[model samples]
Target: MKKFMNFGVLALLGMALTFGMTSCSDDDPDYSNVTPPTVELAKANISGMVTTIGGKPIAGAEVTAKLGSTTLSATTNADGEYTLEGLAENGTYTMTATASGKQSVTGSVTVNKGETAAWNTRLSNEATTVSVSQTEETSVEVVTETLENNEEARVTTVTVIPAAAVEEGEEIIVTPVYSTDYATTKAATTKDFMLMGINISCSNPNAVLKAPIKLTFDLTDDVIAQIKPMKEVNGSWVEAEVTEEGEKVVFTVDAFTTYSLFINATLNQNASTEAISFAQAEYDNLYGASEMSVGTATYTYKMGSEIGQHSNLLGAYLAEILAQQMAGSTVKTVNGSYEINVTLPIGTALTLSGKQAVETTSIAAGSTTVSGKSYGKVSVTANTYNRQHNGGTN
Candidate 1:
């Protein structure tokens, strides 16, 4: 009987131990004291309206915003309104708006976290009204009037459109688009010249004329002497024959695209002749009969055997002129780049090898190559003197 009592006592001890273990197992870990990981939420948005300079709503305009590799796009509604959502907050986006029969516009906007940023784009289009009749030729004037910084000026461009250029009774509109963005426009031309005219485009896309259209610009004699009429062909500016008649400049265009007056000058004013010769020598040595690699394409720049070949010397002279023009500006090397301090108009940009510098407080800085030569740094600032007009009516 004493041995059976001891076995019962041992069984009771085992039951108590098992119960203690069961109670411990039932309790969960204290995860309440641990912190949770953070998750970022996209709460920023960009919304805007795309309209013409006259405040006309542009329907079917494609609006795109780019931030790094992320691109968000939207189409404008009938009201010309568009919105891009779920963008990262506090990020700046480069915005572009493009529509048929309109000049594409580009700008930038910064959106804050949990907020919608408003960015409006005003596209430029044909400003002149035309009524095509059964006439041999029609003449229309495109006028650009500007009142900037309390200063007012007017530019009037006259184009003699031949009847063969457009269909009879088909309305034609021509608009002279004025841009102070010299840096951007300068890239289209191989010449180193200051833009001092307007870019004129017709309402008709890719309109080629059976007969040459007469274009005229009114300007001071001094200005006309320094300017040349250029027409954009195949995305490059080629000099068109220009003549000074009284206080006006005249040129003929067989095709209507972007036409402008470029201020032509030699870069080495003191050594113009010698500079031309040296540049021609360099061109012959570097590019003549040899393939020059640009990006991924190789091009052979053929030159005539003449001493003053137009194409060969043209590129060199223009490059020298541009270099001389910027020589007076302040230059500094920053982070192994050339930084040039130049003052331009408010809307203008400083372009180096097709790369534009970002503007801040009227100052823009960038680094790029110029004519196969790399610069450590370069910059441009807004010219406080707003009266120095490069091109356009105002």
Candidate 2:
């Protein structure tokens, strides 16, 4: 009887323990049906300041950042500070800032995950000037002023308009678009050879002009000779007829949009010795010092120096020597330094014996040749050569 009671007690204890464990498990929370905690994703941001070209803070300026279809925007505070939040991380955004009475600026910035990228922009005051005219034919001189004190800086004149460009008794506004203000236009039209650029537009864009309008640009004759007038048409540049009017360049255009003076790179030159000499002097002046070597002797000179004054004579003598070599002739010179009057095509061989020699031959125009083994070759363009060498140490 004792053994039976012990076995029954052990069986009852085991069953109670299993039942308690089952109950506890059923009462516990159902984690499979409950929702899990959510985690926030990381994002990037862009911050910047907006100011005027003069460095003055621009309050209330609009700053925008765009990446594909997503666009974020912010406004500048009194301190010119702006913050664009919640941008896609590790992306490049095109940023643009704008303010009233100021030029808009655009740039690009990159942001990293959970970080703000800094961008800064400076807006320029509108450098364009507008004038109203009510005459049949009128002239407008557009002038740019210095930024510091608003003093007159550069002036470009537009003149000689027919009645068609502007209707009589109708007020028309003419605006001058400066390159500094319109950099894109300048870059597209001028490349690296721009001397001066002027943009002209009438209030009536559809006005049909019967005659061409004239423009006068402030430039020297030398500069005018090396450049040509170009007009912007449909976003492309086309050559316009240009003329030299005193120290200014005058060009006529049927339509007035943006006209510029660009150095003509393909311009052929029939340069005279005087012109070449002047150019050489100008180059020397710009670069401090320059030298020319002939026959193992080097001549060093600067602008306005004594040696510089003899550029024409030296150039002519060099040309004569080269011409003789090209024509299968020998050039003989004495040991002492002397001057010789050099005229082009001086009959093949030149014999210089410390005395002036005059010789003439027939050679092709605009032909430059170099031939010789004992003496290095010389290249010269002979158009009209008359060089006289007096007693000088050059």
User: Highest lDDT among the candidates is held by which one?
Assistant: 1
- True lDDT of residue 162, candidate 1: 73
Query: What TM-score would every model get versus the actual structure?
Result: 0.42, 0.41
Give the Å shift of residue 143 in candidate 1: 1.5
Among all candidates shown, the one with the greatest TM-score: 1
Candidate 2 structure, TM-score to reference: 0.41
State the lDDT at 279 in candidate 2: 15
Model 1 residue 80 lDDT? Answer: 74
> For residues 154-222, could you state the per-residue lDDT of candidate 2 as single tens digits?
435666555545564433344443232343443343232343466666556676555667777765543
> What's the true lDDT of residue 291 in model 2?
27
* lDDT for each residue of candidate 1 in 1-394, tens digit (9 for 90 to 100): 9999999999999999999999887894432222211112225667666765434567999999998998999998886767676676468889999998777877787775533455665566635666655557789876643212111124467887776566554555565654423224453443335333445455566554556667888766544555567766676666777777798888776565666766533222121110001111111111123222211111111110001111222332233223223211112121111222233322222222212121111110111112311111111111111122132110
- Candidate 1 lDDT: 0.47
Summed backbone clashes in each candidate are 14, 2
Lowest lDDT 10-residue stretch of candidate 2: 301-310
lDDT of 2 at 297: 15
